[model samples]
Target: MRAALGLYLELHAHPELSGAETGTAERFAGHLEGDGATVTRGIGGHGVVGVLRNGPGPTLLVRAELDALPITERTGLAYASTVPGTMHACGHDLHLASAAGAFALLAAEPDTWNGTLLVVGQPAEETLEGADAMLADGLYERFGTPDTVLAQHTAPLPAGTLAHGRGPMMAASAALDVVIHGRGGHAGTPQLTVDPVVTAAATVMRLQTVVSRETAPSDQVVLTVGSLRAGSRGNVVPDEAELSITVRAATDQALERAVEAATRIVRAECAASGCPEDPDVTLVSRSPALLPDPAATAAVRAAHEREFGRHRVLDWPGSMATEDFPRFAVGGVRTAYWMVGTTSPRQWRAAHSAARPVPPNHSAEFAPDVRTALPAGIAAMATAVRQLFKETW
Candidate 1:
């Protein structure tokens, strides 16, 4: 726990953005190396892997994301992010520290278990490209393939609580970059210009129907227009307006339908406004839905329950959030990814009672109670890894 806290403070103070986590990867690799594990650095764009061989047994891989979000730190903690536009708002710092602590603990107690512990510090998780990049660079071939893979993410639930999902853990997601084109003119000559700003606004409003009307009510889908940019000055009408939309769904079919509908709507809306060209819709990033192996999830959950009492462990429902962690299981390897609570009990109670919104994972104000969460996260991960070694070790 002491080790984890120190590492967490250091990581939180200097967060790095996705795809540029060279120093973060170095720090993680150094932490693992200090624990006597053989470390490998720069496996597919700053990905670090630490392998600890104890004896002849099953190989287990534990992964932690090393990249931080682009949001600036709003929390006034002493260890707040020094980088202006980078913050560990999604708790990757906690994840990295906990994974390192787990590695350190397992490495120290060599007799407690016997197997190969593969600790992975994955980069670019925020953009859903890290796991794919690692795989493309031959992560499994370079290091031995694992029999079981495990990972954990931070949640807004109260600290000291652990949550697990039996099947679908997180939704599949896709990002869309849509550029709506129009004729540029002065604001006074509205009759001569094909206004893309108006069309973009219309598209945003109509996108709600894609989820509410087009999709089945029983099925889940989310279409969010995160950014819409147009002219800077009020007097000048821009020639083009750009929008960035994110779509998430429980299944691939739903995701496809949502994107199709979104694109069709954007094109139709622009054409209806007498635009000259068709809208340019680009799929920026795509990630598959995360479905933890049911049996593996059960075993990990049971281990967590045994380690951190059943009262502290809870069953969690599927979330709209997506992850690339499941990509590690592409070759039929079993995978289990769970969530650890980061909220304090007091804050949880206040949010529920006062109807105040709790700061979620990606929020700039998300300040986790590391004092309680760090130890719990480390213990939970360690227990899960140990459980996977039971049959072999």
Candidate 2:
């Protein structure tokens, strides 16, 4: 546990932004090679894949994301990030530690299973590009296309519980960037200027209607305007206004409908506001929903029950958060993604404060309670991987 915590803290102190995990990859690769696993580095722009094949019968792929948010660090911990404008607020440090711990455990007892294990350190999950890069770089073709894939994410749930869902564990997400252009003018001339700020505000309000009125009531959809920037000065009417939106849906059809509705709403709102030109809506990032296979989920649950007792296993409702791990599932392999609790009561209360604003994932203050959560995550993932190899291989 001390060693795991040390690794987590070291990673926390040296957080890297998306697609810039060179040092992180090298550190994990050294550990993997030390444990007798065949390590491959620089596969997908800093992704490291470790293969442990012992007369394989079936292959199992385990993955952990290795990217940090772009927020500045403010946790004030002794091992807080040293980088000026980067932090591992999403607990990726813990994720990597648990992954390495699991690998170490398996390496110490390789005779327990008769198969191949692929441990992947994926980069750029926040930007939703790492999984695509891995696949394009022959992750499946080269690693023998896993029969089952298992991955776990640290969550803010109760400290000892392991949360898993059978189907559609997370929602599909798409980032929308809308740019509205208008004619700029001085504060004194109100009649001649087209106020893009007002137009952008109206567009933001109209975007809410896409989820409420355009989509069906039963369809789970979320349309959020996370950012809006218009003018440089208080009195001047800016020439352009920018709006960033995040859209979530449960299914592909629903996601497509939401995207179409958002495009229509932005165009209509821009026309109604009498903007000189139509707004440009672009998708910055996108990820599909995670649909877990029932058999694979049951196997993982059984492993949790055996290793940590039945009371520790939990059934959770589907989350609206999105993960790129589901892309591996799309390749015809069974996938079960679990949530490992990482928040304590004290941290939860502090995180919810409105004044100081402890932002969740992208916030600088979003540090997981690593001292208590890292070991449980490691044990759960290790037990799941061992059981998967036993059953499949």
Q: What is the TM-score of each candidate against the true structure?
A: 0.96, 0.93
Clashing pairs in 2: none
- lDDT against the true structure, each candidate: 0.91, 0.85
The sequence of per-residue lDDT tens digits that candidate 2 reaches over residues 1-393 is 566666788889998888899888888788778778899988778999999987847898889888888888887888889998888888788888898888888888878777888999999988889999998998988878999988888776766678888778889999999899989999899679888888888888888888889999999999899999988898898999999999999987899899998989889888988889888889998888888888888988988988888887788788888878888875578887888877766776765774554345656667677766888898998899888887886
Identify the leading candidate in terms of lDDT. Answer: 1
Q: Output the TM-score of candidate 2.
A: 0.93
Candidate 1 lDDT, 1-393, residue by residue in tens: 787788899999989999999889988899999999899999889999999999888999999999999898888888899999889999999999999999989998988888899999999998989999998999999998999899999999889899998668899899999999999999999999999999999999999999999999877899999999999999999999999999999987899999999999999999889999999999998987888888888888888888989999998898999888888987779898899999988778878999988889889999999989999999999999888899435
Which stretches of model 2 miss by more than 4 angstroms?
345-363
Q: Model 1 misses residue 14 by how many Å?
A: 0.7
lDDT of 2 at 172: 93
